[model samples]
Target: MLLAILLPFLSFMVRGKILTGIVCLILQITLIGWLPAAIWAVLSLNNARAERRNDKLIRAMKENGR
Candidate 1:
C-alpha cells in the first residue's frame, strides 16, 4: 500500500526517532494505504523517463557537436 512505498522516504525525510520509524514501516503493511503507493509509482516512473530523455538529448548534442 501507499505507506509501504513511503515509509522509507518518511524515515529519510523526518530523521525520526526509532519508534516513529517503526510505526511508519508498520503503517505500510495495512490495506488502507494503497493510494500513496500509486502516487509514488507514478512519480518514480516520471522521474525515470525524464532522466532518460535528458540523457538522450545530451548524447545527441554531443554527437552533433552542439
Candidate 2:
C-alpha cells in the first residue's frame, strides 16, 4: 500500500527509466507474489526490538542490584 504511493518518488531517485521500471515491477511482485516474506520481515524486526528491550531491562536490573 505504502509502496504504491512512493513508487514515483523512488523512480525519480533512481533516474533511469529502465531501472525504475524494473524496480517497480519487483515491488509490485513483492506486494502480490511475495507478501508473506514481507510480513515475516516485519515480524522479525518486531521480535528483535522486543529482545533488545528485554536485554536492556535485564541489564539495568542487574546493575541496580550491584
Candidate 3:
C-alpha cells in the first residue's frame, strides 16, 4: 500500500523503469490523470511480481528434475 503511494519515485529507484516512472509522474501532475498513472504503476508492479514468481518456480522445478 505504501509502495503504491510512492511508486512514481520507486519505479525508477527500485524497479529500474525510469521511463515508466517519469511518465507516471508527469501524468500524476496533471491532476485528472493521476488515477491512470496509479493504475499503470500498480499493473507494472504486478507484472514484475508475477515474472519473478514464475522465474523462481522454474528454478525450483529444474532443481527437482522436473
* Top candidate by TM-score: 3
Model 3, span 1-66: residue lDDT tens: 457555554664567877767777787788778777777777777888899999999999999995
Q: Which stretches of candidate 2 lie over 4 Å from their true place?
A: 1-33
RMSD of 2: 8.5
Q: Note the residue pairs that clash in candidate 1.
A: 2-33, 2-37, 4-28
Instruction: Kindly report the root-mean-square deviation of model 1 from the true structure over all alpha carbons.
Output: 7.2
TM-score of 1: 0.53
- lDDT per residue for candidate 1 within 2-64, as digits (tens), equals 432545436323443456445544554566744554455446546656999999999999999
lDDT of each: 0.54, 0.52, 0.73
User: By lDDT, highest first, what's the ranking?
Assistant: 3, 1, 2
Cα deviation in Å at residue 15, candidate 1? Answer: 28
Rank candidates by TM-score, best first: 3, 1, 2
lDDT of 1 at 48: 58
Once fitted onto the true fold, the runs of candidate 3 whose alpha carbons sit more than 4 angstroms away are 6-9
- Say which prediction, candidate 2 or candidate 3, comes out ahead on TM-score: 3
RMSD of each: 7.2, 8.5, 2.0
The alpha-carbon lDDT assigned to residue 43 of candidate 2 equals 51
Question: Can you give the TM-score per candidate against the true fold?
Answer: 0.53, 0.51, 0.80
lDDT string for model 2 (1-66, tens) is 233244532432333445544554565465563454344334544665699999999999999999
